[model samples]
Target: MNPSQPSAPVRILVIDDTPSIHDDFRKILISRGNDASLDAAEAALFADTRSAPVADSFVLDSALQGQEGLALLERAHQAGEPYSLAFVDMRMPPGWDGIETIRRLWQVDPALQVVICTAYTDYSWSETIRQLGSSDNLIILKKPFDNIEVLQLAHALTRKWQLARKLAARMWDLASEVERRTDELRTAEARFTSAFAASPIASTIQYNYNHCFLSVNPAFLELTGQSMGDVIGHMPGELELWPEGKAWLDGVSRGDRLRKHPAKLRTRDGRLRDVLVSTEPIAIDNDACSLWLIDDITDRLELEQQLVQSQKMESVGHLAAGIAHDFNNLLTAINIYTEEALHECQPGTRLHDDLQEVQAAGRRAAALTRQLLIFSRKQFSELAPLQLAEVLDRILPMLRRLIGEDIELVSEWDSGLPMILGDENNLEHVVLNLVVNARDAMPNGGEIRLALRQTVVLASQTARHPEARPGQFLVLAVADNGCGIPLEIQQQVFEPLFTTKGSGKGTGLGLSTVRTIVSQHKGWVELTSSPGAGALFEIFLPAAPVGTVLEATGTAGAGQPASDRHRGTERILIAEDDDVVRNMLAVLFPRYGYQAVLAQDGPDALAAWEKGGGAFDLLLTDMVMPKGMSGIDLARELQSRQPDLKVILSTGYSAELLQQGTTPPIPGASVLLKPYRPDSLLAAIRNTLDAAAAAS
Candidate 1:
């Protein structure tokens, strides 16, 4: 077995009186070891399964009698690697029968799957059921069964057991986390109760009637600028802490108990501070005393304001996603129809000009929809090892055009900077967003410098930021000598749709997209600025090991011409939900010399395939639909029936649907992101089909 294989085998126990039976199971269940040939054969046979090549390896343990089997199971349970299945013989002699053995095993581990093997009808089905009761985990196997049947049963039951254990573990983890969080909250409340602002909050103990300080915590001393000796045994009026005299101090009993009183306290340095004082009376050493809880509301108010802004941004993100989903469907229809019409018109015609304008408008709207998805953080980006220097080289021309010639753009990077794991295009978007934001800040024009260097971040350095960690990073900085960001609003600069630019000029999503992209790349952004000085935005991306090469990612750029797209007369099946979009694809596929068959959903597509006698050159299906079957399942079924068929899945939003989150790519199918141009979609189909042909 490969040591790096992620999952361990499902263990099985065989309890029988005959030693020969154990030898038979070993021959059927255990392999010498899996190798390249076995893997290729397994993939060929079971490629339709989501987790293919998962032929369960078994660890078989045998016992001569039922009593000894129970002992083994108990020991396995103690070892934390209990058996997933047990094969019990009905005719075990000189001990408890199969039924009793199963009963005892269930008492220890109720989740064990059991299969009863017997040659004679010694215990009828009704008798077995009456003794053991019916269970989903119990099944009966007649003696002399085929080797294939037993092996198949082993594989299926073991996978079922593994899935159940994982689910139970996940539920346990969630319960544990909830209890842990509740404990933390209770601890915080206890700290608030017992300490009375002694730790970080300002606290002062004063005597009654005269209101002279008896003791002051360090926090209080710092706030009031008074030493322990200076504040002790001296009245607040004498020290000028609260120079309004003791009239408010005497009002504790004059109004109500446990009331909050507002006051202005003057520090020794003559600076007045706003405070909320919670006054309560207590007896200390048989004398009346007051414990005043003074809270500085300056920073607290700012925290509350930030909480409100965060809540507002969350609501806006939800709204943006809902709108983008609906808008993209409309854009899909508009774009296809305009492209189809453009082909029928002559050059230099007014109709052609009008259609061209419509297409341009549609293109701009599509770009805005992409921006909205990026802001909402729903845009699918596949992260990989990439060099930032190469990304800069690819986008420098566009960057130069973005910032006018009035602004001087400078690029600097280290000579041997390590690679970072990120989505290359998304990283480019971050650079563009930040530099454009810097350009907007300097209306009169200024220099914008983009720099990349390697740095190490210590734990102490990340103590202040929640999204940062201690590690090596590729630091990308975008700095501008522009009108600096005010300290008051610097924290809100990355908020979605919260722009300082005037209407009709900026959409306020630039910095918002930048923050989302950087964070998604497992990095953090730190901003430093002073009023009218300048601003520098630093993005720190976790660095991968040296020699990590940049990987090629898929793109939706204009592809080869229709002739070069491997145009063919092969028939293709398309399953989509939207009527307009489906009909448009049906019309467009024939233009590339491919025949088309259409269905409204997965089931409809399957029915069409069956009606065509399960034969087609290729299958094109949408990832989502209103029917019971998804495109992934539909493809799996069709591929199982016709092993050589080429398949392509398209989706409007998610790229993870077909593979379902980081599971390896589907063995024989390719994915096309939705709202793809006509030429691009054809190219994807042709390339996939040609590859299938070559493999065959």
Candidate 2:
């Protein structure tokens, strides 16, 4: 016996009074190595005291005994002790025969192996075998049983008991392994649930075709404004608030996986928000489900819109700056010639008064040019304390004339309003543009009100207006009780060249110019309007520190004096490549008392200046001349030769040159923009000479 195996061999006890039966059983047990010690009827009564080691034996001849062998066998089976095998004689005469006794023993211990030894091989024993359910462990030995046959039966029963024990042990081991794996799966599920619920982004799980909600994280619940009980197990589209849910579900159903797709949804609060949704399908237990990840993109969309608007404004500003540069040159010529003609005429003469009007109109035209420059962000701004209320008061009469008589004009100004740091003219343009727009909104006549007041905008308030900054602001609001803007067109109202008015009736640049000017002043514009309700345009400009308003000092018009103009005797070099433009200047320059010298390009201009024998009074050169030699280079060469030579650099686009200062290769030089009238050319020449003489 192995020490590691179960302790003790199975014990068996048998009782019989017949000596011959005992001898036969002993012979069988000795062959099988199972020591069968027979106990006589008297010894069996004191079986506990007889320590000769109880042995398994066949019980026989029960009818001849005072203490029946059947009774002894019954006592052994009822002992509740471990037993391997038993053999009983069928001829035993008692309350139960051998077959019946074996059956009762089986009922007491199904694990106990039993067999019957009988003298007669008859049908009665066969019938009893059938009654015992025909167990394989039960066997019968004939009377006068062979020793080998008895030994074989005992060995077979012992092997059967060993096999049963082994099977039970394997079953318990397999059950434990199954229990451990199930526990591990449960723990993994708990971790997954915790991670999903803790994420900030909205997450959801849905079945493939039906789109039934399997699970949703806390963020999804918060975003949809629904409880877990309300959402779980329901169809996603049944929420009613998510208009695009069906479209997303359909996309998911068509494929096993998908990356992020842009989607717009109406939230539970009825507000439209943009989201990026991604989905992937997973097969679980022969069924498919999808996981959806949602990222909110409302803020990103707004930022894109602002970027588009900024780019549009930049393009429009470039256009405006180009126009203003050319227009200013024309004004300069008109101003100079008109002043000259006025000085040469007698006072009150028709020609003199006509020249006076021309000069006045030129000054107004110059003012318009400055406005365009401001809109294009090309002009230099001198910030000073300015009362917004007072500025609005002065602008009301002009606004009234602009809106015309059909529209009733109204003004409301809060007394002692805070001042703002900005150019007064630019502010006036913003106000005028708003009023004009309002007038157009109501062609049939309506009330237009200009309101001015002091206001403080906090960080919270600035969120609504994308361009607003947190600070004290001078709020200038222009409102009209008229037909309002359509929602579809409201977003594009401030875009350059976008207008609802009929073609030629209004230039779409007005509101765009307003926005540019306001932005340049570090301010923001707020627009509120809807169809059928009036529009309100509010501008918030940063309040300036309290100080005295700086009075701008300058002549009524800044132009050269007529008497000290350059004469034809003074040589003037004109460096312009365009034939028409150069020829026009060539023809116009001599009329202004200057001997004109022409140059087809920058090198030609340099040659002409050197060919003049270094006697030219001024060098008027176009900034961008052909053949790689710019006017600035020519001017520098001329200045080196004749240090006192006056130079005026001109260009169609002077923004880059202007930022480098009003000089070519050196500071403090003069510059004139192109497309100039004759007078502007003369005035520029005269101003250059005056500035040169002043510098000397």
Candidate 3:
């Protein structure tokens, strides 16, 4: 045995009647000084040339009687350091014979190695085997046996015992590991079950072979509007969930792992829902299955579409506003020149009538440009606190005629509704646009319901719509029972130039303009519709504050006609960027009994003012100008020098638009919109100059 090997010394129990036998056994197995004697005896017995074996390393405990030996073996086994082998004298006469002692010892430790030593024929080998019942642990060793044989038996038996103990220890560790792993698996399964039940995203498990639902979470049940009783053991197709049942089943059967796949499913209530589906293969109780996670994105997609539509409209609005502003400048020149030609030509002449037609066309073109500006939210509105009912009542007759006899028009409103601060004409346009859209939606004729109601909005109601605010509002709803708007296209209906009608049938600006007009009034629009179920468009306008008294819609010249009162002889300075409009104004103003001086832009006007010693009575300048000076800047600089300077501001852009980029028009300054007639410009100039004179 190697000394470096980590093992306890092998122990042996000896049973004998002679004291010498016990001492002999110790000398052969435990005593290292007896190695020389053992070697000489081995050499003489065989006359071999081989060297003696390594000194025996063992512990020996002796008992005089068989019973004593058995007691020693039992004590050693109880102490957890049992003997590996025992030498029992077969002729020992004491409390019990060697055979009886060996039987009891084997019972105590079945793995113990035993050797029966006997010189006399107390029993034959066959009789000894019959007594011990023949075991691998039992060996018959004749008395006076060779010392080498005793040493060999002790070493082999002890090493075998050590290996057995190590094997048993390893088996025990393996058993413990298997138990721990099983416990962990159980814990993981429990956690998975709990999480699956608690998750908010709809989850489902279905058998891989049958494609029938094995389990469904509460969220799945709620999302599909189905109960456990309805969904259990049922295929998705059998439940009528998928819009394309065949396609769904085919994909599932193909083992396709869906990740964020867009799908449409019909609910139990027959409403369609947009969902994102994800699935992966799983196994439950040795059965192959698929785990599905579904997310309902109907509302989210609607909001995203609304956001994109809003951004698109805003961009188009900007472009439309710019185009309208530039176009209005051209219209101004056209209309003014046409008016001048009409004054020059004789009435009832062909030339005069042609000029009148040209003038009429110019007015219509101007109206179209104004509509563009309205859609862009750049049109100035003359907002007033008025009863919406009165405005609607005035326009319903015209609407009834517009929608035709096939369509029945019905109007209803709650009494004592609060007033709104909105432009009457613009509000009328909103109502007309919605009603027109409704009428068009029902080409075969249908009922149109126009309703007005006051509503109080809450902060919580604004979660879905970012444009909504918390306040009281007057809701104007136009509903039609006609071929309804589809859910997929509802978000696009409000975008400019997005029309469902054929060519030349619609401008596509109806709903867009309605939204723009409502937004300009500090309001929002809500639309609800289902396919083949009609559409409802609701316009929410902020209500005027309580106790707000309506003011009379009148001006200083209400008592007299505008043309008669608008003449003035005061010198007026005009600044314009367009040559045609500028020249037209220069010629037109002097004809109205006013002294007119012209400049190309604000800087040129400033130099002219300085050259003439600021003698002009009123400064009429365009809002947007050249040479780094706006109309507002020029007025501010001149007013700084002349505190009582009278000024009139003109622009093709709305006042709201000008305020966003530069300084707003000064207080007390009159704003004259472009494409103006000879009367409107003259009225503005005369009013501005006369107001200053009256103040002085």
lDDT tens digits, residue span 240-340, model 3: 88886476657765677888888887899998899998989888899888899999999999899879877987899899988988899999989888887
Per-residue C-alpha lDDT of model 2 across residues 532-591, encoded as one tens digit per residue: 899999988888876757567755234645434443457788887766566666656666
- Candidate 1: where is the Cα deviation over 4 Å? 1-203, 217-250, 253-256, 259-277, 283-288, 293-314, 338-360, 552-560, 627-629, 633-646, 656-668
Clashing pairs in 2: 333-679, 333-680, 567-593, 568-593
> Could you give candidate 1's per-residue lDDT for residues 459-519 as a string of tens digits?
8988757798898999999999998989878877888877878888888888888888788
Q: Which pairs clash in model 1?
A: none
Residue 22 in candidate 1, Cα distance off native in Å: 99
Number of the top TM-score candidate: 3
All models, RMSD in angstroms:
37.6, 10.7, 5.4
What is the Cα-based TM-score of model 1?
A: 0.62
Taking all chains together, each candidate's TM-score versus the true structure is: 0.62, 0.66, 0.79
Q: Which ten residues in a row are the worst by lDDT in model 1?
A: 1-10
- After superposing candidate 2, which stretches have Cα over 4 Å from the reference? 1-184, 206-214, 225-238, 244-262, 279-290, 301-394, 414-418, 546-552, 555-573, 578-600, 613-619, 629-647, 651-657, 660-666, 671-692
Better of 1 and 2 by lDDT: 1
